[model samples]
Target: MKAFDIAIVGAGIFGLSVAKAAHDRGMRVALIEKDTVANGASKGLLGALMPHIPSQWNDKKQFQFDALRTLSEEIAALEEATGVSTGYRRVGRLMPLYTQDKLDHALHRQDESQTRWRTAETGFSFNVVKETPFKDWPAANTAPLGYIWDTLAARANPRLVSAALKAYLEPRITLLEHTKFDRFDEDAGLVHLGDGSTLMAENLVLSAGYEGFDLIKDLTNQSIGSGVKGQSLALKLELPVELPVIYDEGIYVIAHENGTVAVGSTSERDWSHKETEEPTLQAMLDKAIQFCPVLEGAPIIDRWAGIRPKCRKRDPLVGLIPGHKRLWVATGGFKISYGIAHRIAQALMNQIDATSGTQIHLPETFTCAYHFA
Candidate 1:
């Protein structure tokens, strides 16, 4: 059995980020994934790094806001170190206001949360626009709706970002792909692989997304996560679009590199993790064309679906398991995984270090017992 100081299950962005953080701390780390790297939601994401500013006014939304605020610089550093363009673009976000009442509501929310929750240093900007600027877009539909431009939000190619993180951590960490974790022996501090091999580790971290819940169900005696399926599509547009990421009426259209525009996504909680449906594809296309008419003639290049891990309280479960000292969890990041994974991983590393008396003081929400109870 190969022993390590830390073993992380799942090679998604969350797991990879954790591995990198642990490795940075001079801990021997092993990252295990059931499939190829980034094959899960980390690969299928639209890579919108939009912070939930409206939700940040309340105490409940503090964790996500803080995580995203911290991840801004962390992601840039990671990209710089890896020399791999994560396709990170701080192109801002345009959220169209359909009605005056909606605009008023958004303004009120922004005003309420601006002081404490807004990330000004990271270029979080917002303003209402009255006109439809795009020549190919429908004037009748978009002209009436005022839009809010959020400068802090950004987008990246999720696949490339995950791949870059993996490559960056390759020399420092052990990556095991296509290897399933059967379970773990808490007392022995051992992780059992599907090949009937056991790997020893003093500490275990489960960043396995929705699958992590099942692996620990027998020992934990509770459901910690569930899958929330999302459907997305990519269209190769005829003309290049320099439009900021547009969010209107729950649908979003983001400009991608190489003259391609990515439009998504449908939040369907009842759907399974099966192949994409024609109706879903057409529905997304209809909305994309409605938002940006330049996509009318664009060819459909790729369409896919991914399952986001939704927790019971719709927040992530970080920190160590309540009763288990060596076992930890860092999953259940519903839709904000790509945006906040790096920061969450950093916080988890701090928590582990704190347990070992190497550091102290993490936010109360990040502690595992907060959700475990």
Candidate 2:
């Protein structure tokens, strides 16, 4: 029976972040993965770190804003410690405004961002402009009214970030790859593995993406989350790495530093196959090429499909499992997992250590108490 200070079941971004945070605090952490790390949605192509519109802000929105703002520093630290680049660049984002109503809403948010989108160290803008920074990036015809160049939005290569995290963690933590979690023995503080082995830990963290909900349901008899399928396509086309991510509707076109452009994705609640590319991706590709003529004939280098964990409340489910002293959860990040993962780790670690008064505040809506209710 191996022992650890903490045991995390899942090697997705959320679980990896938790394991890294726990290890950095000088704790023996064991990370158990059913498959490989970043095998699910975390490995997806689109790494758009766009924040919510600055109007009608609440604790949830503020939490996301803080995560987006502080991610750059977090990525820098990860890169420095591992000597690997995460392909992170704050290249901003572009939203083509085609309707007068939409442009009016953007203008209102632009004014609201002056106060809502500001931190003590820096501020980001959400300005509406008639011209794009690049020609035909988003053909002027797409934005008959104008475009919103949101300075806060950024992009990261998801694969590179995962690789950097793996590099930083592989040497420090116990990684149980290709191992499935059977169950957690709360009374014994033991995590039962599918191989009939058990690892002892003072605490157990479940960050297994959508499959995590099944574990919780088995324990508490409630379904709090389900998997939402998303598909993305990577193009061989090369564009300037600093180009702002062009986003319209559900389509995201982001140019990475590796000289590849990523376009995606479809949010389907009912997916027939988890990893099969369907016609929805083609439709999105067509629309993306329409928005950016430069992508019209760009050959797709890869097509990816994965399931994103979406909570019933539509926010991340974090914090300690109610009625269980040794169990914790950190999943249901869905689309914004990459942007908010580090902060989620901070909040969960703070809870585990009973260390409060930190700048990171987990929203009430993200709690298991809230989700269980």
TM-score of each: 0.91, 0.97
Which candidate ranks first by TM-score, i.e. highest? Answer: 2
* CA shift of 24, model 1, Å: 1.2
Cα lDDT tens digits, model 2, 303-373, are: 89999999999999988888899899999999999999998998998889865426467899988888999
lDDT of each: 0.76, 0.90
lDDT of 2 at 48: 90
Q: Which residue runs does candidate 1 get wrong by more than 4 Å? A: 117-123, 132-140, 143-145, 238-242, 355-366
Off by over 4 Å in 2: 119-121, 356-359
TM-score of 2: 0.97
* Residue lDDT tens for model 1, 1-373: 7889899999888999889889888899999999988787776747777767564455445556666666667778888888887877776777767787978876876665456554465446555557645543433466466667566677888888898898798877888999988877878988899999889998999988777777657667887677777888887764443556777777777777756677778777787555788788788889768767777878888887887787877777788887788888899877778887876787788877755323433555555677677
- Steric collisions counted per model: 0, 0
